[model samples]
Target: MYIPFDEMVDTSRVWIYQADKQLSTAEQSQIESKCNSFLQEWAAHGQALKSSFQIIHDKFLVISVDESFNQASGCSIDASVALVKNLEQELGINFFDRTKICFLVNGEIVEIPLNGIKSEVKNGNIKSDTLTFNNLVSDIRSFQTDWKVEAKNSWLKRYFQ
Candidate 1:
């Protein structure tokens, strides 16, 4: 998305929790270790999938295989999605929110509030990136659409090439 940095409506920022205040040394160490292990496993799975199939875009990936291969692999998209969701919950980071197009200006990262952004997921336009948000909504609407389409198409071609 071609989000102009000036048009970003920063809503709220998250507060970082102090390590000493939130967790004990042992507990924090355990959490960190578990998180690292989870990340390693997640990366390994993603690498395996990428090596096996063709990735189209950030949101959509497809693997073309015959019945024999499909049966032999038995890869479940639902399970993958569930695992991602669980990982996000454990890590306290939203993957979809991170996918937003950010505009950098003067060494600062600007973000648009997703509160009023109308998602097109309800409709059949899953490929559309035209987000409708409050305040300068029209200006930023086409920004996301153009960028997403171009990036996805470029990535797909590059992957195939």
Candidate 2:
């Protein structure tokens, strides 16, 4: 069920899991292996799901699935959640933590608490031109194009306004 990510086309469904902190090299290797192993057996109601995953910037885990063959069912999704929970416990990494706001400062991804964003912007650490990761992208096309975009164009627009 695991396919080459590049060959999977741009219509695939995507899921992004952000780590609270960057993963170590060893942890990345182990996590990659675990993800590959999981994809090999991942299924949707007995139908194999064509899936692939990759680690980006040593932190974000991007999982894409070509659901053109079989849709991911409730059971399969729950299984994935369970897998992530197990990974969190085993690796001491929290993939479900969304409290940290991720953005680009001088081309580096910076994490800050949401409440502190205003201060960073006010202090000129983050400007109107700052690029932020729009991790809410739902498809491969958007993931490719809009994953990292200007803060003004993202859900943080209200803050900028």
Top of the candidates by TM-score: 2
lDDT of each: 0.29, 0.87
lDDT of 2 by residue, 113-157 (tens): 888988988897887778888888998999999999888887777
Question: Whose lDDT is greatest here?
Answer: 2
Off by over 4 Å in 1: 1-48, 52-75, 98-101, 114-161
58-94, model 1: which lDDT tens digit per residue? 2212122122212213243444345445544664545
- Cα RMSD to the true fold for all candidates: 16.7, 1.0
| Minimal lDDT window, size 10, model 2 | 152-161
Q: For model 1, what is the alpha-carbon lDDT of residue 20?
A: 12
